[model samples]
Target: NWRSRIVFLLKTNSSKPMLHLIGNRPSADAVNQWAESLDKLLNGTTVFSIFLKSEFCKENIEFWTACEDFKMLTSRKARASKASNIYEEFIKSEAPQEINLDLHIRNDIIENLQEPATTSFLAAQVKIYSLMENNSYPRFIHSNLYKKLCAAARQEVKYNKS
Candidate 1:
């Protein structure tokens, strides 16, 4: 009967749109796609950040998020200052948490910082995104931490229904 009831709900629910009442349950595919899931997993929730921090890659997500936010600045003055801050903190050699990037990317960012427009971080951000997508994201999908979070979400939903 539980299976029958579930099937019944699926069939009947089509009559009225079914909204996702629970939150943060990203699908397996979403976990792999960059733009679709990275923001919510990395920036929107503490779970992913906490796990990343433990594994020593939190800086990657933080830098990526800062780049995205920095891109949204409308004022030239704001963009310039933020660009300088990002370069000093994330791009410079011997910085506290220097990201691994190609020399060409670093040099391009250096050149862009001369003017420091909104798009100054574009090339560097792409490189970082690719790094995470190719390297970190797969580990994230398979990590025990992510599995625990998914289990916790399921438990929460089950408990809420009772």
Candidate 2:
């Protein structure tokens, strides 16, 4: 029934579909392919971001991405400054976008921040990654936003073929 409803909507929806493009018109297979891995999902497009934001867990991905960027710094000073900013923003207690982390891990990160290295946030980043991979990602795979994206992708494929 729900599947039929989606089909009907896809059929009757205006020529201007509410499509969120990730590069060229993505295939339905591309959307489905992301379900295989968290990295794929994150690297795929803004669809995951849109879904996560809708679920009020956008900070999870934000923190994860920040950690990734933090890992790329070659300069000690830049790494230290970036690490402090990351801690204040996401790891510190009462931070603006404080992520859910174990007290021990949080304390460990605080200690590491004294001489922050590119790997300083590795553990906390892993924890956040697990949280998203296990929790929000599953929900995202089933969300209306994900479904709409797949449907729109299919529609676009059809439109392009004609």
Candidate 3:
């Protein structure tokens, strides 16, 4: 039922089937179906959707203004949130084995807080943390602060043992 509904919606304007592609347009199935015929056409449709949306948004100031409003919408919010998880995966892979990710993120926020241009982005982060903590703090201790505290704790441990 769902597949048929999707097929119907996609075919409403054109009789051609829309290939929902991610990565590459001419997938194995499309290539197998026509080999060379549908390749260019399918790729063109995907490219058109992307470039057309960008141009349309730029042409209409109302559409540009709606970027934030659209983000509040379920579809846009889901897409936006996916980017952060992708970034987190990259961070985990690139960071040193012993580095604490939570502390790393916090430290990055603190570093950004020092810059006036980035104040708004940092403010959003602080508000989220504040919500999690369930109380207000005089200042947000970012990842760098956490690292320094951990280092100090280690030094204390070493001194006590000696």
Steric clash count of candidate 3 = 3
By lDDT, the candidates rank as: 2, 1, 3
Q: Per-residue lDDT of 1-162 in model 2, one digit per residue for the tens?
A: 433333343444454445543345446778778878888888846667656766789899999999999999998899989999999999888999999999998998999887898778988999999999999989988766666777777777788889
TM-score of each: 0.72, 0.81, 0.16
RMSD of each: 11.4, 6.3, 25.9
Per-residue alpha-carbon lDDT of candidate 1 for residues 1-162, written as tens digits (9 for 90 to 100) = 333332233344243322233244444343344235555456454445555566688777778888989989998888888888888888899877788888998998888886787777788888888877777767766765455445544555666779
Q: Which stretches of candidate 3 lie over 4 Å from their true place?
A: 1-142
lDDT scores of the candidates, listed in order? 0.66, 0.78, 0.32
Superior by TM-score: candidate 1 or candidate 2: 2
Clashes of each: 0, 0, 3
Most accurate candidate by lDDT: 2
Best by TM-score: 2
| Model 1, total clashes | 0
* lDDT of model 2, residue 56: 83
Q: Which pairs clash in the backbone of model 3?
A: 106-143, 107-143, 107-144
- Root mean square deviation (Cα) for candidate 3: 25.9
Which of the two candidates, 2 or 3, achieves a greater lDDT against the reference? 2
